[model samples]
Target: MQITQLPSDQRPREKLLQQGPQALSDAELLAIFFRTGIAGMNAIELAETTLSTHQSLQQLFNASLGDFCQVKGLGEAKYVQLQAVLELSKRFLQESCQRNTVFNSPEHVRHYLSLELKSRQQEVFMVLFLDNQNRLIHQDILFYGTINSASVYPREVVKAVLRHNAAAVIFAHNHPSGVAEPSEADKIITRKLISALALIDVPVLDHLIVADVSVISFAERGLI
Candidate 1:
């Protein structure tokens, strides 16, 4: 049935306005974003079909423009809108991270890192430079390509920390293979970084590994 023909309270937009966004299902939320549908399918049905095609909202959000446009009733315009929404979410999370003590709000940091690194096809190392109070001072991707002892240089990380005048640091890296477990190489490089930073009296607060569906924290696992 058409969305307009449905009862007022049952409509996605009306439901959202009345009960807040959380009251709606994923298809209802997506239907509101869609606004309209193809010849036969209503917005809700279209949204359901699209979600089924992608399997999940995460897969849909992560799809490339070509892949996204391939979906029925979707196009480049929708892809651009989706990307904008994703970037806005990432920025919001980053703003939150900057405002709070990072260690105290570890989930925010994890979410920000996930948005930044989860979809990446290659390995990247990121460092969050923190003030003495553990608020984020600066963040940077210090290394690209393979993340390992040979590729990641402690000297460059030290330079960045000094430049930012950071009191402490949190390290993060993405595993394209979707394994959140820290490898032997990961452990070795982290210890080397710890030793290098310790000489300058900067503490390594945590090391996080971003995987496909999870962010693993070294501190949480007692690996740090």
Candidate 2:
């Protein structure tokens, strides 16, 4: 049955207003975003079809423009809109992190970096500059290279912290091979960076190895 055929309270928009966005299922949430459907289908049906085709929402959002356009109600305009919304979510997370003074939540850090770097095809080294209170000051990608290799200069890392006037920092990099294990080079680089930064009294809070599904922390392993 069409969504209109359902009871007034059962409609997607009505349900959203009555409860909350969190109360809706994936299909219901997607239906709300779609707003309408093509001939012979309702928004709910289109959403269901889309979910079925993609299997995972991440895969769906990551789909290429040409690929995503093949969907029934999804077109160029909608694709661009989705991209903007996704970017908005990333910035929102970053803003939330910036508002906190003491950054002790490892999971939140992992999640934010996962969204930022986990899906990259090449390795990227990032630095999170923090103030004396450990609040986030800035996030910058300092280096990028092939999946297995990235050149990180301890002097450059030190220079960046000095440039930002940061008192502390968390180092992070993504493993394009999907392994979060810290290689021998990763461990060596971490120690060298620690020694170099210590000369100026800046602490290396953590070194996170971001993989496809997991984030490994050197601090958690007593390596920091």
Runs of candidate 1 with Cα error greater than 4 angstroms are 147-150
Off by over 4 Å in 2: 8-10
Cα shift from native, residue 28, model 1 (Å): 1.5
Q: Looking at model 2, which ten-residue stretch has the lowest summed lDDT?
A: 99-108
Give the lDDT of residue 214 in candidate 2: 86
Candidates in order have lDDT scores of 0.92, 0.88
Q: What's the CA RMSD for each of the models?
A: 1.7, 2.0
Candidate 2 lDDT by residue in tens digits, 1-224: 78989997779999999998888899999898888888899999999898888887876777889888888778998788888988987887788778876367666687789889866889999999999988889999999888797999998898899999999999999998888999999999999999999999999999999987789999999999
lDDT of 1: 0.92
